[model samples]
Target: MAAEAKQTCYEGSSVQSFRFFLEHSGEHQAILQRVHDILPGEFKRIGAGKSSLDFLGVGSGGGELDVQMLTLLQSIFPAVPITADTVEGSSQLTDNFKALVAKTTNLQKIPFCWHIMKCEDYEKQVKAKGDMKKFDFIHMIQMIYYVDNLSTTIKFYHSLLKNNGRLMIINEAANGGWDILWKTYKKELCVDAITEYRSSGEILACLKSQGLKYEEHVIPNTFDITECFNPSSQTGQRLLNFMTATDNFYQSFTPEIRAGILDLLRNKCSTEKDGRVLFNSNLSCILVYA
Candidate 1:
């Protein structure tokens, strides 16, 4: 009998695996640092002539990046008060965000409205309110893969932007390791329940199809995957689970499939240097102007 396929990593409790991935992967740090450098110039184009600013964060896990963005906005428009709306599905992550906000004295000028629900539900709530609330800046980072309808969701968020507003999206680059993995093993690994993988290439195509104007920026990143080769390593197993979007991926699949995946991950998706396997996990940032 075949083994039963498990749920996607994000479908259940995913904070630990996600945290482990973030800690081990250089992707997040690279993206964050690049954003910090570029966002000030970008902020100048948004919220112009407005007395206040509104920011929205979709799938705002832990809120570390969100807070940094808010701080940057505050610096650029120091006198303009900011209102931030955070949408997150995980209670633990939401609590972490709230705790961070409570302790951060610098965020005093930005008032937060927390919505402990999925982005889909949050959209419904906003629409049901019968008030068209526009925002100055909205960011959806590393979280678009889970949305039910990518195009519709993108359009909905874009519609919520004020004139001269900016909608920023960051996703895995088309040439990145995640994209390569999904392209090769999607049939074998991806399940029907999840929108398993999406890349900036697809997003760019979607925007082009809709006649939307946008700017693209690529940030190169890498993560050490040498631990993933060790079968007994707990961290390795967790990384494998996140990479495959499967629970216990090291043990769940047949030995042949597991071996093949490991081989591909080592040889095809990563490079070897100094006895370490570094995975190419590049990211792309797309800025859509409204």
Candidate 2:
């Protein structure tokens, strides 16, 4: 399991997996549609009688999701201006987001600020600023694994909310095929890492323990991994690296281990129907209140 000690897998493999998921896989689109269905009505209720909106996005990635969500918010209160503060850990992604913002004329109309740091770092900076504003809506999408303490991080974000403000979180659904694979891969790698795979169930449990009330939405999603069945295939290799959170997992791990992982993915995690291999890649969205 130990290819090299103190080395990280999240930087390369995980990021590439996300890129693949967003581009090739159908799940991102499905999830976005679901968000559109669920969020707009809720935002309408929240924005009732309000003059303007304040938004904070944690782990906003390349701002593609941010733009989609903020668009929905804009549609709700077309006349009101929205001020968004976003925190993203990757400088490359932040730059990409900035570039996207530069090209989009509509995005230019919304006031947006970027913090090229982790959520925790942004929290410290928020404190140091001495004049911090509460947000009407905070969204953390599929990036809680990087937080030092999940409960603490959620609490901190929740604390930064205005009265009746809401915090939205999205993650893999518990007991889903993707969740099972993440658990299996983490056990196989045996790495003591901060970016541990966490599902919505675990996160909601933490919220429940903290006595928070929230609404839950399930978004159905799927990914085609037919290429992954062939070990020599580039797509297969990259999928394996992403699944196991390691680079060159096929070369680094023993043949038996590789077979075990592949068998799990091919047989248990994916369903073959109509000559296509579809992987169950469902995700969940939890809306917590302050």
Candidate 3:
């Protein structure tokens, strides 16, 4: 019944998995800090001349990161009002984001539209409209992996950019802490029909092959998953499941395979320093047409 119920990993508690990621991993801080450091300069170079900015956020999550990025943009162009169009596939996440916006006084001031559909669906809708609207800035943060066709998704989003507009994509770098485990268990764990586990290196290669130009930035970050070493740790088990994009990885794999994966996660993927198990989970950002 468990196996029968498990149709696709993504259809599970994605919001819970995302919450686990933010709570345990340093991704939120690392991403926000990188944007605070790098995005201002990029925005300055663009030099806004209009009174309003058309911004599209693909998979903007629960508006936590969107608010930060929007605030940064406001600081850059203090006079211009931002018209934000957010795209998110998860209904729960979209509702949470809207709720946050409704409760937050500052977020209410910013005009926004929500598209509760997948990127491809949104693309089809826009194309069908006959008068497709272009955006000045489009950002996809750690969301590309959700799409099946990375190349097509990138090109589609790139096509939506106005002249001198910027499209920023953030994803994991190749050979990171989880690379070995991912390579080993991907066939069994990954939902290839919906998700493609491609790192930044692979993405760069794709861009190069397609003759696309972009700037890349590597953000150094780590997360503590020492609990994963303990067989009895439920949090560790969930973390492993989230990392592998599987449902209960500890129970999914055979004893031998599970042991091998745990060993790799402990020794190769992470290191024990000062009594803490730190993982080598860094991220990278690729700025296209910035």
Candidate 4:
């Protein structure tokens, strides 16, 4: 669900997917159109139809990305049964995910299963009952924040795959301006310093350590002011919550300090430009072996 108006327990997990879907899907779809540029040999490896794909997502908050993935998969492998496992701690928007499943069209008729366990735990699960080379494809999106050990997590994802299986990861570019924004969020807006891990290199390194090769995608996205910061938008409301909530944030900040920061941000992120508010988002993604 779009929990922009509330203090989402899922944080950036699901909102990123939904926001991108709503705001940038048109342009972003172009990137999807050029998927070959990103996956190259891996896309060819997914091969023909109905191949089993075990979709693994860590920090899958509200699952909008699952919807997108389902669409992508259906286009290439019609009627293929996909087993989706999402590791999310807790989210105020859980109900939104249930709704997403019901409305999904991409893999609507295909068999789909969702497991709400931790990604780190999948290592043990694979070792316990299943063979390492079972799934055909695996993916991890912007949910790396919840991951405890990147190397360990990647190794496990690799272990779960068949020889042809591949892994994919998408996240904000670590060197982008958003890095500073995230830093500020941690330094100025919370009840405590957020211990949540959010590093892109660490994830890539983990995959490399597992002897998995990957391709990277660098694209631009936006967060419109009307949608993200407008007076009535859900995201706008969430921003208001940030304006008001001090003790629950990661910065160990007092409420007053957060309010001051938001005041400046609101002024900078204007909402009168397009019919919607807009801000540039530089997005980077990588797809590796499963």
RMSD in Å for model 3 = 3.2
- lDDT, residue 235, model 2: 84
- Candidate 2: where is the Cα deviation over 4 Å? 1-17, 190-195
lDDT of 3 by residue, 199-240 (tens): 788789878878888999998889888898887999898888
Model 4 has an lDDT value of 0.53
Q: 1-290, model 4: which lDDT tens digit per residue?
A: 11222332344533454444445324345334434455544544674544565655565556665566656665665555666656554453455666787787555565544555566565666678665536666666555654566677776676667666776776656654344344456544322223443546566666666677777778655554343334456555544443323322324346675565444444542324646545434556777754
Q: Please write out the lDDT profile of model 1 over residues 1-290, one tens digit for every residue.
A: 00112432133346666777788886667978989877999898796689989999998888989988998889899888899998887777788889899888989657898988878888899899978688999999887877788898999999999989999999889978888888788787667435456889889999999899999999889888899999888888888887886668866789988998899999888999999999988889999999
Ranking by TM-score: 1, 3, 2, 4
Error of 1 at 192 (Å): 6.6
Range of the 10 consecutive residues with the lowest summed lDDT in candidate 3: 1-10
What TM-score do all the candidates reach, one by one? 0.93, 0.91, 0.92, 0.66
lDDT of each: 0.82, 0.78, 0.77, 0.53
After superposing candidate 1, which stretches have Cα over 4 Å from the reference?
A: 1-13
How many collisions between residues are there in candidate 4? Answer: 16
Residue-by-residue lDDT tens digits, candidate 2, 1-290? 10112232224445556576466566568778888888887898778888888999898877888888887888779899889898887776777788988887777888888888878888888889877788999998877766778988988899998877889998888877767776787766646443466788889899999999999999888878888888678887776665565667778689998888778887888889888788888888899987
Model 3, position 103: C-alpha lDDT score: 80
Better of 1 and 3 by lDDT: 1
